[model samples]
Target: MSREFEFAQLLRAYRKGILSEKAFEEEMTRLEGGACGGFIAMGKTYASERDAIVAYLQRVRNGEAAGARALEQWAQVCKTDCMRSGLRTIAEREAYHVRVIDRKLNDLGARCEPAADPEIDRFVSMQSDPNISDLDKLRRITSSFANADEVVKPIYEFVDLIKQDLDAKEMLALWAEDEYSSIKWFLHACAALGGAAQSPADSRHEAMASAQTH
Candidate 1:
């Protein structure tokens, strides 16, 4: 790939929370003064690493808000006792995290409006769709979000970036743990239902329909 293309990819990976701060910075230094096809000079949202991470928190909080509502919908209509209980528990956890992260955002003087997360939006849409059965929804989610460590690595990789806000750091750690717990619950619940994983057809449909490409 061209250097400029690779440089653009670096910026995108960081935005998608795929790059550690150290790696992101090193790559930025490496590409300094090199042609990056305007990735650096475009209308970037963040002025610094701190700003970008605060924005990340904002987006995630919005996700929790959406997730809490979406999960509750499933919990209400779910016929299976185990799945219902698991969905409710996860919904409650997400709701609590929403409050926690919202408070943290306000403490840091950040407003979480104008969230532009296509991934969360898509998840909520899929869950809310009437045609998609609840079990199928869970299957798709299990396939995409079963790995707790991988899901939250984006947030943990930037611990050094938020040292100024001890409160936010603490909240993040607690939230990450809860995320791991939630995924485990979903995984076990899926197994109990004998649908421990999404079928290849379902996976392909998810990839084709999912709004978040990265």
Candidate 2:
């Protein structure tokens, strides 16, 4: 049977409650293949309207809404993978990295004599707190880094390395055994950092302009 027909059959099974959402999504992923697999699965998995899955997949593949949706779906998949793999919780993992990076940045800041910012101080403290979620700590770290003029490059490099070490597809595969939200957030963070690195100067200029305007 054609892919569309197969997908349609899956959708019917999904709507009839013959297949759970997770199972339907996995089957779609297996059928579609590649990075696009997630998007296809997402479209087929969550769609309620007739042909909505097909339309969404087409939009995604055509370089329109697919990129954002795919990213979102990929993130969800990542969260699921992390939990199944028995990997360190994202919060724990990020907290560890944040502490390491924050310490290095703090030492650098001390040596450089950059003006102290309370936000940065709070961020450093948060990095070691197991109470805060990884996503929240990451936000705090990014915000704190942005507030500092001298620490910006170091922070960017640190985050860039973390982003580089992550393989979205591989990560997703790990969570393929289950579904979780944390992995999705992790993937989103990685994508955001990757996008930021690809245009650092532009982002800096924009930040500078925004700072001036404010």
Candidate 3:
């Protein structure tokens, strides 16, 4: 059977509850044959790796743009000197990432579709609220992931699946490393604010500081 027909059958089975969500995802991953690189590209399936990359880049572009805006707004409201500096630095990096990703999407002959995310809107509002302490905002953001590395692990995994798209793979690999640095900073900032012991971010602080200077 064709991949399309097989995907349809799987979708029907999943919808009918014949397959659990995990099983359905595994089957979809198998059907894509690594076109999606075994990672759910924003929870959708694509027939080809290029298609998946195009869609994934669009999603990342959107998310990074939102993140940049949110962090900038948070920086404005943040009262702490160090937190404000770090927030602005991260915001700038996120904006730069979006620009590069947008260029890549254009090279692939695709335009980003404007997708509004309500969760992002709420997050921006929360982050920008002057009444919220910087520690609280740090807690809110860092709490989403179990650890710093968890945030960027999927990006590296996806990069590994790119068998032919060396350009995209290299780009994503660098992007993942950047995200790792940002998350490490966030975790360390949170810990310091909460009076917890010094975290692993201490070792990487010099690197993050170097990034800020750039």
Candidate 4:
């Protein structure tokens, strides 16, 4: 096969999760008469590795097998490179990490909104941190509202705290106004709190007999 065809096949394989970096490099080396020269030649035109990867990923998304493989390979390389380099600004690193998490969540068929369990946990953990700002907390809460299931407890607890702190009925009124969704969540949270509020014990054998009767 031509070098171009072989490279394209390698790219497709990588995208499909079939090729390892070592394996890809070995093939490229054998084909190009040296180690990674072919791939390096392809990579040199892009301004940044990330930009190149993004371009390849777009091609992959467009059903180009070679581009898809190149994108996947580049992603792995970029992640490792980022970790090893320690050159990224804090904000850049955080944004990149969040994007990675977002992609994984999307792949899992999760909503882009903040409703999932892990997303809620992340927000709650951040809120509990003494270093986090109130304005940031408000932002997170607002973003979280779009996916209410994940933030209901935190929202209730936060508003409840505000009600106590301000000694005002306004906070309570605001909470009450969201009663339909909040009440159901509150009930569920209460049931989850263990002790006397826990769900009733169920006998598996009794449930089986009941099911059989039906």
The candidate scoring highest on TM-score is: 3
Off by over 4 Å in 2: 1-111, 114-116, 141-187, 190-214
Candidates 1 and 4 compared: the better one by lDDT is 1
How do all the candidates rank in terms of TM-score, highest first? Answer: 3, 1, 2, 4
C-alpha-based local distance difference test score of model 3: 0.80
Tens digit per residue, CA lDDT, model 4, 1-214? 3458778999899788799988988877766652233222132444332333333323222221222222233233332222212212322333443454345334434424422355434544564454653334334434424435544454344344321123222433343344334334323322332211333563433343243335
C-alpha RMSD of candidate 2: 21.4
The alpha-carbon deviation from the true structure for residue 149 of candidate 4, after best TM-score superposition, in angstroms, is: 16
- lDDT by residue (1-214, candidate 1, tens digit) is 4557777899899999999889999877755633333222113534444465567677677778988988988777665554677688999999998887777778668878846778777888787676776558868888876466888786676554453346666777788889888887666555545566445554433442242223
TM-score of 2: 0.19
Angstrom error of the Cα, residue 140, model 4: value is: 0.8
Q: Which ten residues in a row have the lowest lDDT in candidate 3?
A: 204-213
Clashing pairs in 3: none
Please tell me which model should have the higher lDDT, number 1 or number 3.
Answer: 3
Q: How many residue pairs clash in each candidate?
A: 0, 10, 0, 2
- Per-residue accuracy of model 3 over 1-214 as CA lDDT, tens digit each: 4568778998999999999999999988777665445434556666677888987798788889888998999999877765778899999999999989988998889889768899988898998899998878888888788676788888877887675578999999989988988988888776666534555547554443344345
lDDT per model, in order?
0.69, 0.39, 0.80, 0.39
TM-score preference between candidates 1 and 3, better one = 3
